[model samples]
Target chain A: MRFAEAWRVALDALRANRMRSALTMLGVIIGVASVVVLVAIGTGAKREVERQVEGLGSNLLVVVPGRIDIGSAPAVSRLDLADVDAVSRVVGDPSRVAVTVASGETVRAGRRSDFTTVQGVLETTPAVFTRRLGRGSYLTASDVDTSRRVAVLGAAVAGALFGDRDPIGQQVSIAGVRFRVIGVFAPLGQSLGVDRDDEVHIPVTAAHRLYGTQRIDGIAVKAPDRERIDDLGARIVAELTRRHPDTEFSAVTQQQILGVLGDILGVLTGVLAAIAGISLLVGGVGVSNIMLVSVRERTREIGLRKAVGARPRDIGLQFLLEAVLLTSIGGVTGMALGVGAALTADALSPVPAAITWWSLALAFGVSAAVGIVFGVVPAQRAGRLDPVVALRAE
Target chain B: MATPAIEAVDVSRTYQLDGVSVPALRGVTLTVAAGDYVAVIGPSGSGKSTLMHLLGGLDRPTGGRLVLGGREVGSLTPPELATLRNETIGFVFQAFHLLPRTSAVDNVALPLVYRGIGARQRRERAAAVLGRVGLGHRLHHRPNQLSGGEQQRVAIARALVTDPTVLLADEPTGNLDTVNGQAVLALLEELNTESGVALVMVTHDNEVAARARRRITMRDGVVVADSAADDPPADSAAVPDGPAAGGDADPTAGDGTERAEAAR
Candidate 1:
């Protein structure tokens, strides 16, 4: 028999048992939907991490203080301005490096007070972190050299302290020291749960005086090109170890961070897909059960068809097509539901969620495979029925 | 000479029931030429239905040879047997066997579907045959919507749509009332005489068997009496009481004998 005829017959049978067909499809729908939603979340997080790392500069590397074993206890090692300068010299180009030191503090503007992070940074901070001024000018090299008490308010901090009013020239007290706001940085949104828009930036010397600490938190190094980032990171790590022989520090390139993030997210996506696949297996078993029952119920009809010259393969194809059609419809419905859920999540929450084309294809492919895998037993059983015995069936 | 439409040479069949053999047919030899309307009648468990099944290629004999449409039924593969049945034999069951929730036209078109015919042609042919069975106006009505006579007619249309060499009907009117049964028998008579299609019917009713020009009475899985002159026996009283016993009651009986003679 032709596939078209078998498909039509299958459709007719399914239509005759509408409630049973729908119930059979429920498992597949849930499986596909969960897979789609979970994969979307995983991909969304990976994309968000990539965006944040790119924002920090594509050819960037971060060098931070690492713990050192002093005697029987683990001591927190410090990285000072001298070590930053020494690493800059090792980098061989003054134009390729920026350094920053941060401390959490309470900032008060008249009656408005908010707990926010304050960072001490050089003039090159704007280029290294891709921060552009929304109003007024960024700090100049001369400002940092003179240790001027000026600050740059992050977009969120500016909004909180001054509301709609411009805060570029306003005074804000940080750790009980008042400083003029030099510029309000452009909005940078949140990434990996950190709000980049809710921070204050000041000169390194001013931050050191305010926080009573001369130690730097971390140093940022920029490669001339993406290809040189690993080499630059290696050179900075070697130079830091040479300068502070007893202390420890580690340098990580943006690529390393992205690779680690991808591995973690990829595993997460795989695990979620596996869990969803179990539901698909359950759905397939359900299809097999229903088809077996259908074959038993329609034994007389099968015998009649056989009497009319239908071959065994024809009957088998009809039932198999019915299974495929059921699962495919469920897959389509599940895809729509999954995409709807992802879009809803994106709209309501800070975590990004998106449906990719590959995920859609995978879901459909798996559903079809499920149909065939589960459809085989019942189809074979129907095909192997004895026509005379089947005719005798009530 | 052309081969007979159906010929059974000492055919026998036995069923294995729980390691015990139950014989259904034992050495039943018969010949049905093309265009011959033959009825096999007997009481239950006489193996007449087994003969019908073997003739239709629905079952193979455990022993002996049964030929249908000039092909040895025992030698053909399962698929080849299916094809033979599809193209050479049509079956009309006692139950009508029309698919429920399906229109009469679709039920008629079912045989053609297995032939790989396209939908448009299948529908056109199904409609034509249904019209022949006097169901043209009721083509779209489902089986449940039709009366017993109408449903039987639809089943006849399905059997005839394939234009097979012979129609094998097992108690075709067993589930119908007298008026409907007589109507169906009359229709079968017309098809055999006018269309020249062979007919093999199994019936318990002597009145129904009387309509056929040829009659075979089975007892204990063997043909006890055959109306055809070639199979005459001394004990002719074994022939049941029917118009078919006289042989001259049917106007077309002479023509059937002449055709059988010409083939030989």
Candidate 2:
């Protein structure tokens, strides 16, 4: 039989039961939409993490002091300035090593004093961490060499201290000790949903001597290149292991952290997406059930067509085409709704959702497959019907 | 010496219901030459419809050597039989089974579609045939929009569109009024005379049977009479008395030899 005639018959059948066809398609729509939205959310969160990690530069490594023994239990490690120098000697890269000591204290600019996080860092911290200056100039090597009491304010700190005025070459007091603001750092938007432009930067020696603290809290090291990050991280771990055998130090490369985060998100997205995919199975079953009912209802129409000279294959193809068309239309609509949801969620939240064309193609392809898989039984029934009996049926 | 247009040898059909075989047609044999108009008349249980279904190749005979258009029908596959039915035989039913939602033209074009004809040519051919059957004015009207007689005419138009050698109709006028029935019969007569396509109609009306050049009367799964009338039954029948004379006002009611007497 002609394909056009078969399609005409199928379209007529669809028009005959428009409401039933639409409701059957709704199942597929919900299934497709669920998968799209779920995958988008997971991928969006992952992309946000990647952006943050990349912002920290690909060659960076973070060293956080692990558990240490106290009176009765393990206490946090008491990492010090000596450990930073020892780490630097073993690594043999002066530009890469930087020690940071931080404290929460009130800083006064003129008459206003605000409670903000104050960090004591080496002169090379900006270079090591890839931090850029938005105004004036950054700390020079002479500043850290002479243990100068100079400070640099972050974008948020400068705004809070001077409002619309420039804070370069201005004096700000930390813990009642005045320090010159040499520069203001550029604004870094939220990283993991926390504003990073709100802290104060100062030389490490000034922070320890002024606050009467003897310990350094953290050290950030930069490798020469992305390929050396893991090797450098291993070398630093070996040095730290030899220097402080009893102290537990955890050295994590940025790539390792990124991988771990990606793995966790992958598992989460996979599970959510798998559960969402079950709806498609239910939708497929829904299609088969509706097709079965349709075949029963149109038994005579099929018989008449066959009697008038329709081939069994023609009847089969007609029913199969109807099912495929229904699911495909539903899939397209569901994909549209899914993309809209992803875009709206991205617009309103911090997650960066990117809808790709491949995802939409996948949705439609699955929908068409679902149609064929489910349409088989009903199409076979319609094709195999005896014209004599079918024509006699009520 | 030419082969008959339709042939059946010792054809028998049986139905199995609740594990019991109920015989419908037993050891029946018939033949019709091309261009002949014949009728098979019997009571409801005499298996005329079963014979018609078998003759049209809609169903296979349970036991028979059947041949149509010089091919052994019993050996043909389902698809081959369907092709033969489409090319060589056309059927008209009592119910006028046109697809409910389609136009009359579309219903007539359905047979051509099954023949793998293109859309444009099929539509044109369908319109042409509808015009031949005097349904050109109702080309786009659906079955519900047409009168009973008009719908049957459309059904007849559909049957003739393929130009089959034999037209197998089962009670073509069973659902129409007397006047509409006569009109349909007259149309069939005219078609047979003009086109010279063999016409085989199943009916219980003696008056309708009288119009055919040949008649076969069946009783209890067997052909009791097969005759060619020099003077048709209507011209000779005026006395209405008993079952032996085949004179029941209800033509379907007849005795054992009534079919033979009526044929003579």
Candidate 3:
């Protein structure tokens, strides 16, 4: 028999039991939709992390005072201004290196006291990173050399301490010491779960006297180009280790950080998609059960058809086609629902979501496969029935 | 004469029922020629239904040679036999067996679906046959919408739509009232006379059997009498309750010609 004719017969059978068909398809719909929505959320989170990392600087590298490998404990701060100079000599560019030493402290400007992160940084902070000034001027090399008490207020810190008033050149006290605000940093929201706009920046020498710490927290450096980042990292790590001698130091490039984060998110997405697929498997089982019931209910009809002229293969194909149709329709509906949910999630929720074309295709393909895998037994049973005995059935 | 539509030579069918062998047909011989009108009459479990099943190719004989449409029944595969049935035979069962929720024309057009015929031609042929059965006005009616007599006529149309050489009817009017039964029987006789298609019927109604040109009576898996040549035995038709309604006949001792003459 023609495939088209078999399809028509299958469609007719499904139409004869509209409620049962729809209920059977519901399983597959939910399975496919869950896979789509879950995968989109994972992919969206991964992309968001990548955007934040790239925003900092593409060719940037960081050197910290520890052997920053798996299971290694963080060490005491062994990096100081001398280590910064040593890194500058190896980089052959002074403005390409910046160092920061941060601790939480209260700041008071005309009795508006706010407790926030206060970082001791060099004049090269703006040149080494993507941070920008909103008003006034950034610190100069002469300010650090003279141990000048100048501060660059973070967006949030300035808003809290001055309340929208221009704070540049205003006097503020940190740890009982007075300092003049040199600039205000632009507004930057949270990245990697850290609040970027909730801190203060000041010349490195002044913060050493206020916090009474000789060692810096970490050093940031920008390579001349993408290709030389690894080479620059190796040289800086060797130079810093040589200077400290007794302590271990590590230098990491931007690609290494993004790669590790990507692997974790990728696995998470796969796991979620697989969990959703279990529901699809259950849906396929429902289809198989219904087909078996239909065969039993129509035994006399099968015998009649066989008595007239239908072959066993014809009967089997008709039943198999019915099952495939059930799941395929369910799969399509589920995919649409998933995409719609993903879009809705992206618009209304903080949880990021992005639909990948391949996820939709994979979900659809798996649902069809589930139909064929689960449908085989019932179709074969229908085909193997004895016409004589079938005709006797009520 | 032309090749007989079906010829069974000492064919037997033994069924296995839960580790016990139950013989349904034990070495029964029969022949049905082209355009012949034959009726099979017997009590329940007398092998009349078994003989019908074997003759129609819905089953195969366990022993002996049975030829249908010029092909040995034992030699053809299941698919090949199905195709042979489509080309050479049509069946009208007691239950009518019209697909529910489907119109009469489509039910009649089903057999042709296996013949690779286009849908339009199939419906047209089915409509023409329905017209011959006097059911052309009810072409679009479902089985539930038609009376028992009209349903039987629709079934007859379905059997005739393929233009088969032999039409097999198993208790064709068993489910109908007397009036509808007579009407369906009259329609079958008219089709047989006008078209020259061989007609083979299995019925328990002695009056129905009397209307046929020939009759074969079976008992205990064997043919006890055959009026294929002359006439039914004198005693066989006299029992209004039906010959063999007694339901017990010698299973191992019966020759077709001798027993028929002995009864006379």
Best by DockQ: 1
**Residue A271 C-alpha lDDT in model 1:** 93
lDDT of each: 0.84, 0.81, 0.86
Candidate 3 wrongly placed segments (more than 4 Å)? A65-72, A75-77, A104-115, A160-180, A210-212, A238-250, B229-264
Question: iRMS of every model, one decimal?
Answer: 1.2, 1.4, 1.2
Highest lDDT, which number? Answer: 3
Instruction: Output the lDDT of residue A277, model 2.
Output: 83
Give lDDT tens digits, candidate 2, residues A107-183.
99999777888998888787777688899777777776677878888899899889999888889999999999989
Supply the DockQ value of model 3: 0.52
Question: How high is each candidate's TM-score?
Answer: 0.81, 0.79, 0.88
Candidate 3 per-residue C-alpha lDDT over B65-94 given as tens digits, one digit per residue, 9 for 90 to 100: 999889999887878878888888889899
Q: Write the per-residue lDDT of candidate 1 for residues B78-140, one digit (tens) a residue.
A: 778878889999898999999998999999999899899988999999999988877789999
List candidate 1 stretches off by more than 4 Å: A65-79, A101-120, A132-187, A197-217, A241-250, A348-351, B16-23, B26-28, B134-140, B210-264
Evaluate fnat for each of the predicted models and list the values in order.
Answer: 0.66, 0.47, 0.61
Report per-candidate DockQ: 0.55, 0.44, 0.52
Quote the positional error of residue A57 for candidate 1 in Å: 3.3
Q: What is the lDDT of residue A298 in candidate 2?
A: 87
Please say which candidate is ahead in TM-score: 1 or 2: 1
**Model 1: per-residue Cα lDDT over A1-394, one tens digit each:** 3678889889988999999999999988988898898889888988888888777776888887773222444235478888878887888876567887888999999999889999999888887767788988887788788889899999999999999998878899998899999899989888657999999999998888887888888888877888877777778888888888887777788787788778888898889888988888898889989999999999999888888888889889988988888899988998999899988998999768878999999998999888888888888888778788888899
